[model samples]
Target: MNGPFPAIAEASATGETADLFADIRATVGVRVVNLVWRHLATLDGALPWAWAAVKPLYLGGLPDQAAQRFRETMIVPKLASLAGDAPTSVDAVLASYDHSNTINLFALGALVAWLRDEADGGPPPPHGPRLRAPDVALPVLASEADVAPETWALVQRLNRLGDTAQPLILASMYRHLARAPAFLERVEAALAPVQADGFLDRAIAANRAAAHETAKRLAQAISAQRPPLADKIETSVSAFIDHAIAKMVTICRSIRVARGQPL
Candidate 1:
């Protein structure tokens, strides 16, 4: 199935596009532009307009606080005890996934909330306690030619983890972590039990619902500071927010299950 927009590959980016890529990574504390931004970059004037609208919120700490608030407020199931001791590598992989998921979920959630408010013709939400973005070294997105064959195959498999009908959206998380095949393998094994038991499905649904609600509240909190977005840019940003939030749900579920959490 064809996606709505093609991702602008980092290798081919130039001038403004390349600069935008760097800014996105630096601002969001990520190594690569997540699929949402990459897809936005494909649309004429969409990426810049959308970024301008949300840059202040991201930089001013609303996103980080929103994320922390989510973690503090949401009620998630407890992690099941693993049958055997996990290796240090497994722990490392889980930590990496957690970091990436937390950052994306909050930032994307805030953006979506603001977009929703804009669409609904409401005042922007008020701000919460400001917090600095976490300092974490994110893994670089691996080029296909640079990755080992087995690892690349594993990345493809991981990307399709939750598919049943439509094509599963490929998450940047897997591609970024493709550099560590062992880590992916361990994560896959750790999640196998939850996947088989249908726990992963429940977790994904829960995360998606929670994200939507969080976005709504965040939008209300930051409504007063909402920026003016053109119709074309609004439409593009809205679509990106929808897709990105859904993907973030999947990423969150995968991270939870990988850590032996229940739905």
Candidate 2:
């Protein structure tokens, strides 16, 4: 699960960090803690505070509700269908991220909005049952050793989509799918137009803005009291919510939409 950006390897986490990782997986109904959370843990004092801040949103089903609303409203663009007979494992990988990222986007988005005071109202009351993650196992995120040289390069290239600015954190989705080079090859073919025509960033920005606004509405669900959070923590959280997670959510879900699959 290593990336260009620094993060605590989930397996190597110990003591409180390990405990937080476990809590995240259980509460989010996902098998693994996401890269963002793991990255946050790399910073001093960031993980514990941030997790404490956001855990209530997860418990109250605020993120679950927000994610459900988001699914209905997402403007997924059309892409050419991927041609190939990939295994069921491919679907499982995408579904795992599709479910996990959507929830994290809102859950973390709400945290960002609340911290910035972009949303009105205080914490929300409990909103019944939390949404369940799909029953799927995401492939272990691939490293260069695990994939062909060309495929590893393609994975890195795909990670740079919409990188008019400096490259953001490497997306774990591309890495996860690297185990299926042919699948990623088709993905590159399908998305090349979107990237070349400058639609990729537009689509991602629109989705991010929409999620940001929706998350602000859900901001009342944040349970943390207002105090000055660390600048580094705020900056990192904002960047991920603004960039990597949003972009991947759009791309992964768009792929599903084009394939006539349920997202």
Candidate 3:
């Protein structure tokens, strides 16, 4: 709100001509406000797509079907996506970006006002959300070598979408990866003392042993594919191996608790 809203509102208040461009921007702005409100209702840590979604709303005029598409695709996904990452302490995702609620709320309000102006035969204004920092690059999924095979695959999917903002997506990736063996290895490797002490080394070896056992059992099940699996279980064993490795990383990470914590 304070970021872009007040300036836009002041411009609207002070402009001599109620032109079409301004009006269109105003319309798009209003849609943005509604989006922010809905974002609040679906509160969690910031979404990867939040900023990207805003861009279309502010820069491109809200199409007639925009809300419907949003309801079906985005609204439903939000329920499942935030299962592990919602911020219990915070009420808004915008706060994660260091913006005060005032600025966020206001920017959206001004955009709404502009939209109303457009509905009244004001000029068709500029539309679509503007990225605050256009120079910021999207985050890439780390390679399989860097991350567990499974986490790498999921992260790759998320990175490819490019629909979400980089930081938000990365945060989610990290949050979920936090539950994977791949993340733990990265953490342990980062802390030399932890490794030198053998605390991390022992833990990693033990976890790997368990994961291998599980993968072997899972592989057997897949190969044993009974009548139901007859020609239907056409997936390659290699593919299953990769998936199993990834799942193992995720499961291990999920059950992991930090050391040096009070019991």
Best by TM-score: 2
Candidate 2 accuracy as lDDT: 0.82
Stretch of 10 with least lDDT, candidate 1: 75-84
lDDT accuracy of residue 67 in candidate 2: 79
Cα misplacement distance, residue 254 of candidate 2 (Å): 0.8
Better of 1 and 3 by TM-score: 1
Encode model 1's per-residue lDDT on 123-241: one tens digit a residue. Answer: 44446655443344555567678899889888877665544424345666676667667767765666566667776556665665676666665554443343444454555544444
Error of 3 at 102 (Å): 42
lDDT of 1: 0.59
lDDT of 2 by residue, 1-263 (tens): 44445888888999999999999998888888898899888887888888998898888888788778778877676789863588677888888888889989998887888778778554553376677788887777788898889998999888888654464688888888888888888888899998888788888888898899878867776666554546677678888888889988999898887767765
Residue-wise C-alpha lDDT for candidate 3, range 39-90, written one tens digit per residue: 2222222211233223334344232122222213211100111123323221
Query: Runs in model 3 with CA error above 4 Å?
Result: 1-172, 175-192, 223-256, 259-263
**Candidates in order: C-alpha RMSD to true structure:** 4.9, 2.3, 22.0
> C-alpha displacement of 75 in model 3, angstroms?
39
Candidate 1 ranges beyond 4 A from true positions? 1-4, 73-97, 113-139, 163-165, 221-263
